[model samples]
Target: MNIKLSVVDQSPVHGSHAKIEAPRLTVELAQLCDSLGYHRFWVAEHHDSVHFANPCPEIMVASIASVTERIRVGSGGVMLSHYSPLKVAECFKMMATLHPDRIDLGVGRAPGGTGLTSHALAFPHEPHHGDLYAHQAQMLEGFVNGTLPADSPYSTIKVLPDSSPKPQLWMLGSSGGSAGLAGHLGYNLALARFIDPDNCNPAIFDSYAEAWKKAGHTGEPNRMLAIACICAETEEEAKLRAGTAVYRKLAAQMGQREDFLTPEQVQDRYKAMSTSEQAFYDHILKGYTVGTPDQCWQEIESLAYQFYCDEVSTVTVTHSHHDRMDSYRLLAKHL
Candidate 1:
């Protein structure tokens, strides 16, 4: 089975690093991946997150697309529920005009930040917040094709400076509901396995594909799965560096999603965990790829087959930028 590899730069800010360094690091990673010939490099969107630094992925996409060649650069994705589709359409369409086939507009259903931020993003129009993503997606589709029902209010709107080869549209989701929607819309689906692996079951893939087939989508199903990895020269070294990810999962289990803890910081926390808690963390770790290059390759290949993935995107975070780059380099060698 052939599998394509991609990267998701979460822009994680280690306890010792400045938040400002995240964008620079992301750019460097994108350029490095371009040289390495990764299929795509995606920038994540986050707002007011203590660990992550990126607030706007489109700007990062523009920057990465400008600096790199061949590799597709996009939002891992834009949170549609929070923004105007017309504006998002304009921004990405203009980007597509410049970059042509290199642009991807991957829209997500998540809030992208704190609840307060989500509310603020829905300001001046709060009632529609519940069903906003569905509406946002519909308008985005209309604007992209330069078509909406003539009777619809938004039919008059047109994304300015349109060009051929508009940005490829994709749906980013972590749950069955969102996956089903992606299938319904006939958009390329990218599932976030790194978010909640236990819940991201094979059935979810079946669910998405079923919906896609039911929707009569004759085009090829563009399925990409995102998985976290901590590839190193040795399995022992990789596991040691993966403490941050383990702790991040532990924090998620504890209802705190902030990933400010480093491997050193997490050592005490990990020690303090009960045997059951440690076991739980280990189970989550097993879902992730944390080993040498060969090990990582095997894990990725297994996941690609499991999910029937045409492409697999990796999310890797380590304390040092150099080590992280080296991890990607080694993995790319195997791919």
Candidate 2:
């Protein structure tokens, strides 16, 4: 299929590890992936969440890029609704100044937190009255490229460290809602298939391609899909490790905040679940690619082909750090 593999780490607080160790693990993973030849290593942003430790992906991106030489580092993404687009552009620009072409500025419209936390993030400023995500995105690109309309109030303000290459801009969305906007504005589209597997299909890429063509873009659309995946030497081992992911999804659905459970702990919890709850867990598992290395690669390749995209970014979580690390190592052997 001639596809590239990437990573989107959520800095999960797993098993007995302290919350602080998650970010360190992200760096460790990035280093390993860099050496193993992963294309991009992106961190995630989450606020007020027990499962994920990274609230600010920009800082993590800089840290990861400093240690890794080749892989692209970026947010999976920055929630643009919470901050000014100019500030976001400046943050990425500063990183690009340090890391050059190795940086990516992937932005999303989601709040990245609970409603109360989302509200607090916008404190001191009046709640925005409308859907300004598109506007923010446009302004962000304008600021990044020094291309804001001449009449705009901020047109005269130039982003500093401007001589350095700019970070690649990406619109991150689970559904196809932002595909046209991303294409029309010349940003790459990274569909979070792991977040919304049901709606994630070739049509999203088609939408982006159509919009790109309509906007007079001259070449093929630049896009990728991210999937939740787990790998092990055997099917049983992979499914066992995936229990942690299934339990994490259950906990999130129930509004619970707990460290990621070990596979053993998840097994116990699964036995205790009612039949319906068990069904829910099984349903979540269906969204993930979990199996042996060959099994995972086959599905990932098929998905990339189906989506007409050349890159597939993986999001993997396991309670045992060794198992998690080994999963990527095994997957890399296929490459």
Q: Highest TM-score among the candidates is held by which one?
A: 2
lDDT of 2 at 289: 97
- Which ranges in model 2 have alpha carbons more than 4 Å from their true place? none
User: Every model's Cα RMSD, please?
Assistant: 1.8, 1.4
Model 2 worst lDDT run, 10 consecutive residues: 122-131
lDDT of each: 0.83, 0.89
lDDT of 1 by residue, 146-180 (tens): 76889988787657744345788898877666878
Clash counts per candidate, in order, are: 0, 0
Error of 1 at 179 (Å): 2.0
lDDT for model 2 comes to: 0.89
**Local error of candidate 1 at 302, Å?**
1.0
How close is every model to the real structure, measured as TM-score? 0.94, 0.96
